[model samples]
Target: MFTIRKATVADCDLINRLAQQSFPATYRDILSPEQIDYMMDWMYAPANIRKQMEAEGHVYLLAYNPGEQPVGYVSVQPEGANTFHLQKIYVLPSCQGQHCGRFLFEQAVSYIKSVHPAPCLMELNVNRHNKALHFYEHMGMRKLREGDFPIGNGYYMNDYIMGLDI
Candidate 1:
């Protein structure tokens, strides 16, 4: 139902807006409001997103329906020569039931394949308490490891690192 396009620096603010819409809702049940706000500002602020595109090697893919109505987004960052990290993937709340998540996920894999045609590793860290953990598992990712990583202000991301070979 949506077309995927590579996001540019100009779309950083839009990406931040989308994150503001999805990130808190995704973590609401598992995280405190303070932590949510902290992460939102830390990871999704427009300046941070701009830096992710400009300085880091992250490549964002935005999903839009007809007339450029945004539906979802996913980002892949190359790590080393044979591995890619899925840094972010989300479907807007309004589009949750429409299977956009799977679409975006497959698109991410496809994007990775396009860039590294040879077999490579794709990894993502999912919150241990997040329901999406099962989604990642069902999509054929296996838990590579788990860890509690400190972010700042006494907050930690208790996450399961999952991986798939592509």
Candidate 2:
């Protein structure tokens, strides 16, 4: 079984470590090694994680097994009236077949529904070639459009923006 807990700034190191392991594991096949390294430092740096939790209005939830080892995590931020942006969602590669992603995604939606009760929707950007595309579709999200977001240092995120009605 797994348990979900709200993550605070104190969890920055844990989140960063998890991202370091999970991000490359997930994207290694789809993205270049340089790109993956760039994105990891850009998004999952401990300082960046801290800023996200403490100042960016992002809510992060962590999923752990009985041994207290983090298995997955998700982050969401309110983007404006009636819309929340799903900034990040990752499950350890070793834990992929265990429904950890589903549990985290469902928990994220549930938490958002409870706190912001409205006919809201959640949006997320998934890599165009990410295998998780089907997973998100299975969870009732539809692709809205495609985007090539320039992150920095000549890196661009080729993504499909997907949305889920709440």
Candidate 3:
């Protein structure tokens, strides 16, 4: 079982900590260790998370296990009137098979539908080599496109842009 809650800026540190634990493990094999470290600071820094929440309009949700430990997080951002981007979703390695990822993905859809009840597109860019691509496909998302987008520090994300109309 899991509990999902909306996050405030004060929870940035918690989110960062969760990312520190899960993000590296999620990308350890697919990315270079240097890139993982760069992305951890780039995406999971408390200041960056706060900026995303306050300035960028990204709504974040945190998941907790039955014992009240934070195990995962998801964030969704409105890309356009009819498009929403699943910016991030990660579950702790220890919690992977327990449906926490599915719950977080569903909650993200629920949040999107709550805000834009009309038919809209939900998109997520997952690493082309990441195992979660299969999970996204299992969740009914189809590959819409793929790109190698540059981030910074000579790093690029080669990802599949998957989508589902909800």
Candidate whose lDDT is highest: 3
Q: Candidate 2 residues 8-57, lDDT tens each?
A: 89999999988988999999999899999899888899999998888999
- lDDT of the candidates, in the order given: 0.93, 0.93, 0.97
How much is the lDDT of residue 87 in candidate 1?
Answer: 97
Candidate 2, which segments miss by more than 4 Å at Cα?
none
lDDT of 2 at 59: 95
| Predicted structure 3, TM vs. truth | 0.99
lDDT of 1 by residue, 97-142 (tens): 7888998999999999998999999999999999999999999999
Cα RMSD to the true fold for all candidates = 0.9, 0.8, 0.6
User: lDDT (0-100) at residue 17 of candidate 3?
Assistant: 92
lDDT of 3 at 154: 99
Backbone-clash count (model 1):
0
- Spell out the clash pairs found in candidate 3: none
lDDT value, residue 36 of candidate 2: 93
Clashes by residue pair, model 2? none
Clash count for each candidate, listed in order shown? 0, 0, 0
The 10 consecutive residues of candidate 2 with the worst lDDT sum are 64-73
Model 3 backbone overlap count: 0
Cα deviation of 15, candidate 2, in Å? 0.4
Model 1, CA-based lDDT: 0.93
